[model samples]
Target: MKDKTIDYLLRATWIAVAKMYNEEASKKGSTMATGFALLNIDPEEGTPSTSLGPKMGMEATSLSRTLRSMEDKGLIVRKKNPEDGRSVLIQLTDFGKEMRIFSKQVVLKFDEAVHREINQEDLDTFSRVAQTIMDLINNKKIYKKQIPSK
Candidate 1:
């Protein structure tokens, strides 16, 4: 399409990337979100249940569902945090550690392929543009009311 909007491009690119990851995850009997969560968890120290949502950019409901699925699959275990009695810590099982390594390799492979395909200058510009967009949104400059009428 001609004159594609920035948001359209961003959304389309994300959807494409998500689809690719989903396909890969399916081969492992898992979802992309599950792989992502696995990657975020600290293999040795474990991660807090409350922090997983923010780390994964997931909603509480979605994170809870994913955590439950992982638990059922024997990929993760939950333990009460000794420091904070009210909080729970999430640790991966031995199987989960193996899966985490696989997930890491997949991510690294993607990065390698992208770097091979895209030149450094272009990648740098893309990174800068993406960061700017995130900053604008984070600062509330992208709010509907804040955007000037075109």
Candidate 2:
């Protein structure tokens, strides 16, 4: 397309960010997804397995696979939720806590860089625009259902 659309820019930016994160994570023998999951899980109080999926905006299958990999790497352990017998809690191992700190630093570094480069007003505008887009999608305002008359 000759003209770029909002989605194009959003997707391209996200892809670039993901690639940059993946590169940094690779040095630590991890992936962007793993780092993301680590950040989302509560350090003190473990998060529910079912909640992790919605919280991370990931599908169950993908989250399951990532959890499995983390488990294999000794990053996390699944324990029965004391309060909810039916649900499992995802708790970080000591090693997982260490990696979570690393992930947090990496994210903070990126945020610092962006703040240093962009002016506050521009950043605020960008944030507002992003939120508006999300609101539109979440509120189902983008596409309306059409009724066909017989």
Candidate 3:
């Protein structure tokens, strides 16, 4: 059936992508997560865990732990917001910015590979489909990672 075919293709694509990611960064963890968070956050305004959760689809507590781990990694530093002491703003450390720059290469490679794999028509269709899926899932927020339970 068409539904089954679509499901199979989607699952296969996901597995392939995940496998590629694992191979590319076997030791991936806080660094990548921090990079993603840094990417979504405002470069100047910064952002807080409460504002970041909806984007990453993670719970606030989960985002907090992830930020703590990244802080321990020295990838980011959190400061209590001066305007609102109740909130904390996150900023990437110098090391994190360097790491993010390096990781951009990985993203570039992924983009090149994707472009090579799909034709123009397919790419357009994919863009639309992906957007539709995200719209269904994201609730107008950005992307984020879930903090693994300890």
Judging by TM-score against the true structure, name the best candidate: 2
lDDT of 1 by residue, 1-150 (tens): 679999899999999988998898888998899999999999999999999999889999999999999999999999999889999999999999999998888889999999999999999999999999999998888675655669
Per-residue lDDT tens digits for candidate 2, residues 85-127, read 9999999999999999999999999999999999999999999
lDDT of each: 0.93, 0.97, 0.72
Off by over 4 Å in 1: 144-150
Candidate 3 lDDT, 5-42, residue by residue in tens: 76588889988876665565445553445555656666
| Model 3, C-alpha of 71: deviation from truth (Å) | 0.9
Ranked by TM-score from best down, the candidates are 2, 1, 3
* Candidate number with the higher lDDT (1 or 2): 2
Candidate 2 steric clashes: 0
Candidate 2 ranges beyond 4 A from true positions: 147-150
lDDT of residue 50 for candidate 3: 64
TM-score between model 3 and native: 0.71
Clash count, candidate 1:
0
Q: What value does the lDDT take at residue 63 in candidate 3?
A: 80
